[model samples]
Target: MLYHGPMAVYNELIGQGSLKEDDFQRTIIETLQDLHDRLMKYNPEPIVRDGKVAPEKERGFFSKLSKVFNKKEEERLAKEAEVARRAAIPKGLYLYGSVGTGKTMLMDLFYSSLERTDKKRVHFHNFMLQLHGRLHKLKTTTHQHEDPIPFLADSLAMESRILCLDEFQVTDIADAMLLRRLLEELVVVRGVVLVTTSNRHPTELYKNGIQRESFLPGIGVLEENCIVKCLDGGIDYRREKKTFFHSAKPKDRSKLASSSTMPTIVQDSSTILPDTLVDEKRFFWPLGPDTKKEIEMYFKSIRNGFQVTERRMNFLGRELVLPHTAGPIAMCSFDELCAKSLSAADYLTLAESFKVLILTGIPKLKPTTLHRNETRRLITLIDALYESQVKLICSADGPISEIFGGGSGAHSIDEDPSTMGQLTPAQRQMMDDLGLNDVSQVKKSPIFSGEEEKFAVQRAESRLIEMQGPGWGM
Candidate 1:
């Protein structure tokens, strides 16, 4: 009950029977609605047509002069209004809760209710990826000594005064470092309001990360700049009973049934076969050549079923082949999918192609030997799939936490130099930029390698856990 305000839109929805009346959702919505109002108040620029002021229709020169004077006065008032709005911009809302608790639904409603066109609603991972790309571009194109974060933040502020980020978390040091700076610029300097949702509170974020002390400042910034509220929507909405249908007869009936006389079977017939005539549990047929052949063919076909099918496609000016896909599901090893040079566009295509993804052979991602590129790829893939509502079924060496934890060095980077060397040129450049030349160095500077990856893995782990629940994609 920390949030209290006139939630007009939320109340309207409850009255119209669109949203179920829940205290948790209502409080969060009321807070978000209030933030939305403040954001609108802070940005009072009216829409202009064709990027030019319309001339008055009056023919008199005096009228034109009067119109010009009025325009100047309006401009001054607008400037004053902007200054006042900046000072009065309400603290943004950070809604945290368990999975399927209507956090996203409320955020969506709040985002839609806002009148400002210069606002963005995106998953946090994707936003960080874009920011990283922009930083890289600025670093390569611009001269040294000019930090790109402020410039990038200014560009984003120009585009969107409010950022409604879903699943705000920090697992990676790179992202944590960048995020700390980015949030400072966006909130303090650019006056960009943030409305984000997360599963963890500010104090609990990146709890046991490597060099977590360095990342703790972002938590302070978040708590200071945003109103943190938890939505205790007890039950996960995605949890539902799944209906399963099983086959009545086995595909290889001869192995489990009597083969003396074949009974004529009719589709949809309800007649039960007599137990005395043929024992349902006894096997009478020997393993002949035909039966052996059938079994071999079955296993052989399954082995060859998911052949690596590739289609060349262009993503962000880089030519890459689409990963092997089969119907509404795709199966690939973690290395195959994440080790290669893939981008958000590729993941988007995969999400469009497959409703379910089965990724196997996911080694434990320890902070000591973290696969930076693979971890980043997995993060991007999860962001794309989560946004597209694709169900993920991954088989890792351990649970989500252990796989991405700092305790075990089971899958340390030192275990495989070939895998470490698989980083794309861009990724290698990024690592070099962070001053990480070898695994030993990365181990020493956990902040450089583990921070962003840790945060990203945490998010991916959360989404994976949520996808396993009953009503995930529904």
Candidate 2:
């Protein structure tokens, strides 16, 4: 079975008879066997196994399939030519793909299969982050260098013949400039096999609106110098058959809501706390169960209507209302929510305002573990809100905490002193105040216990320094 990012794609592929079995691991093993069989005919000599074919003819199909991905016809020919050239004079390979389409997995398998003398794989994000830190150090003190890119590129070029980069998209201009120079100096001049994966289509990268066109010459260099391919498989290869995984679960009707443009008095049928008079001018309703219900109902209406907007959460219930920047903003507009593109800053800001946040789609991450990291980040965001005295209400297929709880990246209680030192004072206080100082407390409160105090102290120090501004880190 070939797995892609989406579980539905996997099911679709199985329905189409593209995959022989349902199990992802079994499918991977079978796929590797097929790839090895095909590649051996082309190499004759063991290109993979040090010029000697395996004695046992082991079925390592998945490994090879990952190594050599498919591209369009023209690009496929170009890649083949590049491969041939690299055989004579070994260089780097760059493997790239859309998000969650197995680009990293392929490279990982390839790196493992190669002899220790032959190859190495390094995730580009980790590599670049380290490089940036090193460069920061190099910039200070006595190590002023004329050509930082060349200096850094030379070091990376010499270290490994095969370099596989996961999540190889760049939105930062500083990174763009440095990456262009470093890749040119390392891959083209020094000969490094560069394998990368991205969420973007090749032509769409740095698309039309970007300022630095010169730095984007790397794309042309790739076109002229290497093979670039798209894994246009209909199947989503990431979803294994054994597990029932879906991108998102259906929303609950209990959370649905309704509202009108004019002033409206809403009253709870059972309890007579007060008749809430919703100010017509304000687009957002005050935090209430009815408001949440209204938002939910509105989402159902919009999804049914098929409307879309650039806004993350659309105010379908009213116009002339304050465009809410915070609070329990609900959605009746399905298309807008689904099509929304959120930035980290935006997310942080939204988190600051609202007690509860609901997102439908499950993001696909390479190595699979990063998904959990993001989940933790979201949970941290929730905790950030909880500190400000907010309640989080969410519904999912299972409990939100249990969804991906068992994975390697799952949040585990740490009893070690090291974990305690990592926390901020504010976080520690919040945890302790909420009785979240123990492992049991963590289950009750979103805050990390005891450990948060140190982190809080560090943050305070940093904030104080930042108030001075510019020269703070310096």
Candidate 3:
């Protein structure tokens, strides 16, 4: 068989009508192809930490004699070789852009084109979870003075010299602190190639984090090591109605994915719920007074009531009791699932127990600090359902998009003093001249002001759209 690279694969996909042509994606793909070519010829070198001596390599007769005869000179030669090796290491890409710009798709293409087996691809969240798990184990066995980074980095780099991560983000301080040293060890010391994607730039990572000043040095280390590029101003390709998503059957599980490959959303229209979403089969919305009763009817319609009873499931030493339950079908409220302090694990357990879930009373969560936690939990729930191939039926505040920030956060900015200060004098004058000041003259986003919240909301919207298929249950 002839070897086909990512460029060929991308073009093939476009030709097959699986993808549409976009100049932005093309340019990014070209760069990735170059990196792929570089990776094919690349060879791994031994890890060499700063101020620490590198492990000696086997030498020939003359070189081994020199090591015994002139220990100092041999050490000097070793240091020089290490420096050269570091310089020769390939600089991987750090692609940053808004959601739905095909970053992950391009990454997948690159990954698929790779002929090597040493590379490992993972989601950023799962990677962090694994990292934290390793750290926990190391902490238990090792002393406080012993740093766990070296062991962890070595283990990871040994498995994957080329690490391709999607949705790279930092939400907390511990990750913010640990990531810097971890990257330094893996990329700088171990010569690992990091090909990662994010919605934020290197500077924008953990922008709202506590004690963020300490994390800046890590940013410097990351920037100095990788080729950082922005893949923005492109359409969100996620909203496009691929037949694979809209037409799958519940029994045809092979035709479906365990989870949504949702990364970006794009349509000729920007509205969250397009006409396509109206009266969707698996996903229903627009919470009215009768919405609850309607979903209940649909639930009972799935099967004539067969001894419905609620039960508690054991999870991580705690019991989570779900209400309104049958054998493979369960029912709960949005507040019960999301409004309460439930976790992704809890949602996963819920998904595993039921083939179909009916949830009610989802609200229009305004994009603010207050709604951040609920929105995050909702996203987690959706992810678990999609991952388990569990079907979800629900009635909500509006369409999936309108669930957060109520579709648009547009309001009158002229009346608010804080908002007026944000506009230039000329801009304000123009608004006044057009009599638009009284209207939505200044359309500020009613969504999250923070990047983290915005990213999560967008993710939820995209996934919710795809989950409305017949093959939602496995």
Candidate 4:
């Protein structure tokens, strides 16, 4: 195979494990290429600069250039020479762009192709989290002189010569402060080439924060030590959605829908009969401008007989399991589930208890975002799910991660708006003006019993009689 670019040669070597680094770099590059191919297929518009799908203007130029470069012997010598030159180079490459522009894809490709003999790729968020965990371990340890960061560095340095980080955003105050020193020790002092992708331009990184100026020199060092490329297609790749979701079977859809039986109101309480089951094939239903109370009522009714799955599969091929079960019932609205704001623990508990969590109505959460608190909770949630091996089924406007941008406690959330941050006065005001903020401002007086009303009337009459004529109630 005649591999063309520097990346191609690197990939070829790396794939064979003949490269000096380990598989981390090779994996990263392959992941990037995978992401690019996935995006081009799933997204309605272009994100990657498809060399095959070049503009009309460039085709003629390429045709003429191809004729000039048709010497097989010369090309072979040139490719070898170019590979040698790149291998000897000590510097790295920098990719920066807006979110979803495939900077990550490019970087991943680059990282994957490199010899796994000495490469590493990590998400900035994950890297910091690991570092923090190490720090925590060191702090609790009995050894007083042991440095956590140095311990981490020792591990990192053990088998990697090239490091690649995705979403190189520095927003955490503590991370920002320590980042300069960490990179210095890892890349500068250790001579490991560093590669990264960022949403913000390097000059604008760590912008307008406490002592941000201090990080500028480090940014300068990065600028000086790398080949920076800004692939600005001036297109919002994220806005395009070729498909709402993956091709799902009916079983998959049913797995996400509410399984509860519709409960009937008896006197003051809602009760679901044991025999009731809801047969809702469609997993999601959109709600109009609905109130929280309405959502609550809906939740109450559905949970009554809540045995959609259990009832449906009452018997196996030859065995009878719930032989007394009758028929399927109506589904309860999921409006309440999405409306009720939950604590991290509660959400986690709920996730553990239920096989399905149907979130109906316009999902208030954008998959692309999580608040700082949400990010932390979500990361914990993801970790918990991974450990528990639980699958998440979300029916939303888009993909779960994309809808809420991969938020961060490590990277500045500002770089990714889907990240958790306090809303500004202006933003809050906008929401308030639109009536989106005060969702519960409107209310109706509680409906009272006829007997209760009569009791109040009788009490008022008795009090009036006592005040007017103390002698008798004729």
Better of 1 and 3 by TM-score: 3
- 1-474: candidate 3 lDDT, tens digit per residue: 765577887787676655677788788888888888889999986544322466678889998887688988879999999989888788888998876666766776787677888888876766776798788887788534577788888778878899988778887667888897898888888889999888789998877555577888889877987889889855654565552232222223223221233222212132221122323465566777577667877777764445578888886677777878876778888887888778766777788677668888888775442455676788778766765556678788777767776533222222455653264454456456644543332433111234466676676676676566423343
lDDT per residue for candidate 1 within 1-474, as digits (tens), equals 543223765675556544457787777766776676667567534333223356857568887788687997889999998778556766888888775566766776677666667888887767887898888887888624677776777677777877888888776677877887788777866677788888788887866654678777677778887999998768543332121101011122221111222332311132221122221111111234553444334323333244445555566777755465544446566777788988776788777666556566667655434466676677788778877655465566665556665432234635566655254455467677765667544444434435445445555665555555433332
Question: TM per model?
Answer: 0.56, 0.38, 0.73, 0.43
lDDT of 4 by residue, 1-474 (tens): 754333564455445443333344344444444433332233111222211244556458777687577778678888897666444436566677554344554564454444355667766656776677666666688335654555555556655666777667665456767676666655554455677876667776666544566777668767765667675554432233220111111212211111111122211133323222222122222334334345444445545544444322211122212212112222222232323333334434444443323333333232222332332333344333322223232233333333233322122334545533444343356356644443222111001111112222222222221212111100
Candidate 2 stretches greater than 4 Å from native = 1-87, 90-98, 240-474
lDDT of each: 0.61, 0.39, 0.68, 0.42
Q: Kindly report which residue stretches of model 1 are placed more than 4 angstroms away from their true locations once superposed.
A: 1-20, 44-86, 143-145, 208-217, 240-309, 313-335, 338-349, 352-380, 391-474
Sort by TM-score, best first.
Answer: 3, 1, 4, 2
- Point to the candidate with the largest TM-score: 3
Backbone clashes for every candidate come to 11, 47, 4, 33
**Which whole-number lDDT from 0 to 100 does residue 370 have in model 2?**
25
RMSD of each candidate relative to the true structure: 13.5, 23.8, 10.2, 24.1
Model 1 Cα RMSD, Å?
Answer: 13.5
